[model samples]
Target chain A: MDDEQQEKQHLANDGRQMTLIDQIIRNKVFNCRYWKEDCFGLTAVTLVDKACKLDCVGATYSGTGKPVPFLCLLMKLLQINPDKEIIIEFLKSKDYKYISALAMFYIRLTSKPKEAYPTIEQFYADFRKIRIRNLDGTFAIWHMDELAEKLLSEEIIFGISLPRFQKRWILEELGQLEPRKSVLEEELQNQEQEQVQVAEQQNQEKDQEQGQEQ
Target chain B: SDDGKQKLNDEDTLDETEYALWKIRELKRIKQFNDEKNKYEIEKAEIDRRRNLTDMQRIQEDFKLGSDKTKMEDKTKYV
Candidate 1:
């Protein structure tokens, strides 16, 4: 065999050795009481299991669906833990678009319909503002980042901690739509006022009956 | 004969009242069910719409990136 061919074979063997070393290190790092094997990886499995435990502990006093949002929020919050290198490694393998979509789904799913729906619209609007370089040498708009950031941030409904850039983007998006938010608040206030009026009328009738009896 | 006729008329009135009440309750139950079904249908449609939009967006991006290569080659040849 040629000298070059022998060298190549030796390099390939070294590469295989390094891979084995990496696997051994990973196994040692993850084979702990807190770390559990999951579909995605050890860290994701551990986080989900921990979240499920928290869910069970809190479920005794509340209804089922109500705790889902909080659990989801907690999962996102857990991602921000400084020791989550494994989780971060798994997330890095995901495409940005896919990651953003999943984040948006999580955010929306965990949020209240009344609050989350408007935020969803806002996310779409922000997505419309993303400029991409089109093939025709023209700029086109995309909203994937904006949507992702909005989902990541804790500002809209569930106060979940996201990465810094995502939080900033969400804040900027929310700032742009402050007027619409105020209008929604005003409408909610008006509805509450009407409810109070109806309740007062019923109370007044009861008071009048008691006065007549006396 | 007059007393029997009156008794028959009273019995018919009672039957009509019972039938009307039962019909009203049935209609209400049907309406409630329809409302709940419509809500689920609306939610399903919204989810479908979002999925379609996402798919179209991805396709549009792929088309833009893919077709641009041919256009670039054409420009290079013309130049």
Candidate 2:
């Protein structure tokens, strides 16, 4: 009983860690049923298992704004403060999209402007569909590219007030970030090359016809 | 419909919290169903539009158009 009463070693610094989530939202997550049961004592490893089961991404739902399982797991992540490598692994994984989204949401909430923009912009080419649970308990489909765009630009997503980061244009002006290249740049270049080739072929055909006539 | 409810087995010993989670998932499943239905309606509308038929002509061509989820019956719904 005495040992059980002792705070877990990993949770010793939770006071500082708890500041990651907003005060009101943190209280909601702590009081939520999912937090009490599913998120109890979850470490970084077990959290991955929970994240894989998530089908939709949102902070809360049902008009009442009950905290969703995704939000609870996010709060658990804030409490645990997993290593950067783990968070990166979650971001880079292609198999579990919800896990990647969870990582993205965490990065948007916690990372500095320098880190967040470049990290999120890399996923702009991912056009896969994602299920989003709206605040009214309705489901809406959003593409991964759309989610990435919103994360970089939108002030509020999923019901949480994101930490304000410097605008991307400002960062680019300071030469802190490279101007983001569009995914269609290569395709457009290929189309231009094809057009040039077609024009050259027409010129060659005309030259051949003129030579034949001469 | 209550068809979304899963039948429990004797081996399944879920507490109230776990059951609540299941209920939430059930609600999400119903929402997913509606989204799927809406997507089908949108795709069907796109195909119908591509067929180059006027709205009134489309309704006349297909008897089931009255029951269509695309709301062509309302006339102004889509515009």
Please give, for residues A66-172, the per-residue lDDT of candidate 2 as tens digits: 88788888877877778889999999888788899899888887788888888887776665557777777666666666788788767888778888887665677
In candidate 1, which residue pairs clash?
Answer: A127-A143
Candidate 2: Cα lDDT at A3: 15
Question: lDDT of model 2 at residue A126?
Answer: 62
Given candidate 1, what's the lDDT at residue B69? 50
What candidate 2 gets wrong by more than 4 Å, as runs, is A1-17, A192-214, B1-79
* Residue lDDT tens for model 1, A1-214: 4323433464465522112112322233234223222212324445444333321111001121222222332333323322334433433432232332333444354344444444444333222122222222233333443444345434432222322232222333456323223223465588899999999999999999999999
What are the lDDT scores of the predictions, listed in order?
0.38, 0.72
Per-residue C-alpha lDDT of model 1 across residues B1-79, encoded as one tens digit per residue: 2232233221122255554553454444345535755676688787787577776675676577775455667777753
* Model 2 per-residue lDDT tens digits across residues B1-79: 1121122111223466645554454444345535755676688789978589877777675656465646665777655
List, in order, the clash count of every candidate structure.
Answer: 1, 0
